[model samples]
Target chain A: MFSWFANPHRFVKLSDWLVPACYVLAAVGILWGLWQGLWIVPKDDYQGGDIMRVMFIHVPAAWLAMASYLGMAVMSFVWFIWRHEVADIAAKAIAPLGATWTALCLATGAIWGKPTWGTWWQWDDARMMSVLFMFFLFLGYMALRAAMDTRQKAARAGAILAMVGALNVPLIKFSVDLFTSLHQDASVITAEGPKMAAVYLWPLLISSFGHTLLFAALVMTFMRAEIWTRRAAQLRARLMTGD
Target chain B: MSGAPILSAFRQALGEAWAGGAGALLPLGFFAGTTVLVPLGVGTEPATLRAIGPGILWVSLALSSLVTLERVFQADTEDGALDLWLQTGAPAAAIAAAKTFAHWLTAGLPLALLSPMLLLMFQARASGALLENMGLYAIGGIAFYFWGGVGAALSATVRRGGLLISLIALPLYVPTAIFGALAMGDGPSSASAPLFLAATTLFALAAAPFAMGAALRLAAD
Candidate 1:
């Protein structure tokens, strides 16, 4: 099956149909999640009653943001070793989306923290710094890629960085563990499973899945654009050569 | 060049710092001005200054390297001297070592010399902290430039490379900053940290030349 999808044209054809389906699923899932999280789920007694609901989207976005970078890092290794153009394009496409997800995480976290944690920001916290570090890494990666004059060179530079920046992924993940910080443990990726009640948990899962689907669909759309753009450039070059 | 790498590197560093016109001197000038500005801006409280002195020293070291890293191969690439370096019989590592040593001598050494003024400007009183921080900064500066040589090598192919050079160099710089800061910590220095710093600096020095050389070949290719 991996071999079957190895062809970019075949992958493009497959993604065309799957992309719309993913969008439909993502839209339905997100709407259902928001409705359940906001209207149906019970409020927390410790924090502001209704404010706790924001975790449905906020937590999922944070997870997906980090996940996307990890995904990009993996693709970078592939690009470096295999020299796959698709891998490079995928890595490039995920960066902005990952950055957006990171921003959403920070913004929503701040909003939630304002009522719960009693502040919008805290510096001594490892989690906050890790998030900031992720943001910087994302910006740095994007800047590095754009700084290059040619696509291949950019891809090469970006691939090396993505791999090296992989070092930061674990650092970000474990910062809360290693340091005495305000950031909480992994709610979803834990071994003992989620600690939240089923009512709150269900919406969280749906929203997280919805975001993942959305990310996949967006990446597919970007890949299609990149492939088309490259082909168009090639055609222009051919015409210039009077072929 | 056939003698010990240490002597050859030192000689080359001294010679190359003043080579190829005045552009090489720009980092030295920039380092001097920035160091002077630090003292002037921080007021004359010696104790207060000493507390923040190490941090400021490292910051200048990093920025000074940033200014000159572009020149490592930037002018050479533009003028085609880099191509000749690539084609030379000398090992790429030797050339990388020479360039790094030259970078440290011209950029890093001047920053180290100017650091006392900046520290004095902050009103640092402790001579021990000053000397220790100075030593750490000098060694860290050499380590930093070697890593930066990798960035410069990779960036030689780009037109406006300064921004990308910073992106690549800054992440690798965190450990140096951390160790350099820890080395100047309040009590007797932490045993682990200085050892770690020395090991990291040696690693960067030994490993970066090869990585940089490979990157240069890739850029050339």
Candidate 2:
């Protein structure tokens, strides 16, 4: 599977059909989720009524923010060990998406929190701070890549960074948890608890699945464009050398 | 491998740091300047200063460590010292560690020793407690220098890479800053706080050298 997907042509061919299919499915899933979340489900009074609906957007974005960071790191590892250009392209593609999802997560969480937690921001909140830090890590990876003068240096530096970050994500999370616990009782997420009804659970799960599809589709599209741009650059170089 | 490589690298780094006006002292200046700004920026209420002081100091120390990292590998890369070292057949990881250890010794250690002064500025007393907080700064120093060194090495060959190094290092500084704050906070200071802070320090100590080594090789390329 590694070598199979390692080929840029294969990726291009596969994503040609897959990308469109994903777009349709993601649109369906997301629209249905938004519709159900906003209008269908009965908001519990104890859960802060209408504001809890933001969970459909916030929870999925939160999960995908983390998932895509790991995905980028995995791609970086693949490129680091195998020197597959496609893996590098995939990783480069994923960084902005992961960052965007993280931003969405933060924004929606803040929106959700204003009423529930009584504040728009809580610096001591472990989850908020961890996700915020992860967002910076993603941006740093991109900035590091851009700083390198050569593509190879950029890939190597970015790979080392992504791996280092992936290793520390758990430790950062744990330390943030410790820091918060020792300092104060952060507005616990236990307000609604895990006793979520099936009505709320199904939409949340489906919306997460849809968001995952959308994120994957976006990554594929970016990778495809990058591959084409590289090919064009190579052709231009060849022509310039011949001339 | 023998300790020769680390010892030599550490010695050479210390020598260079000393001759270069001991750039190690530079972070202390920045650390102090930042401490001065915090009270001015936040106003000089003793309670407010005391409450926010630990966090602000840990964060400033983390930032101050970053200022010196821009030079960590840049000087070696510019002078071709990196090529000479790599050709010496030494383990790259060891060399990276030694230099970073030396960096901590110079830049990070002074900041750690001066933590008492910072605490005093925040209205802290108790000489015994002051020394303990200084030790906490010592461990926090390890995390800061090693992780920041990884960024410095990665950006070593890039011209004007100071901002890039800060971008890369700041996120990595999170655990150190967080744990150090926990260790220093008067509220519910767990015995485990220092242990967790040490764990972050040790984690960075173990991991960052290899990353710096890899990045140094890339810089040499």
Q: Which docking category, incorrect, acceptable, medium or high, applies to candidate 1?
A: acceptable
Give the alpha carbon lDDT tens digit for every residue of A1-243 in model 1.
Answer: 334545688878888899999999999888889899888888886767789889888888888877988999988888888777778888999999888988999999899989988889886566766676677677878987887778988898787667756753563344233335666666655789777678778899998888889988998888889888998999999999999
Q: Indicate which candidate wins on lDDT.
A: 2
- Clashes within 3 Å, all models in order: 2, 0
Model-by-model DockQ, in order: 0.31, 0.82
True contacts kept of each: 0.18, 0.78
Q: B40-59 in candidate 1: lDDT tens per residue?
A: 78775666666777787688
Off by over 4 Å in 2: A179-194, B1-5
**Which pairs in model 2 have colliding backbones?**
none
Please write out the lDDT profile of model 2 over residues B86-109, one tens digit for every residue.
Answer: 887787888999999998888888
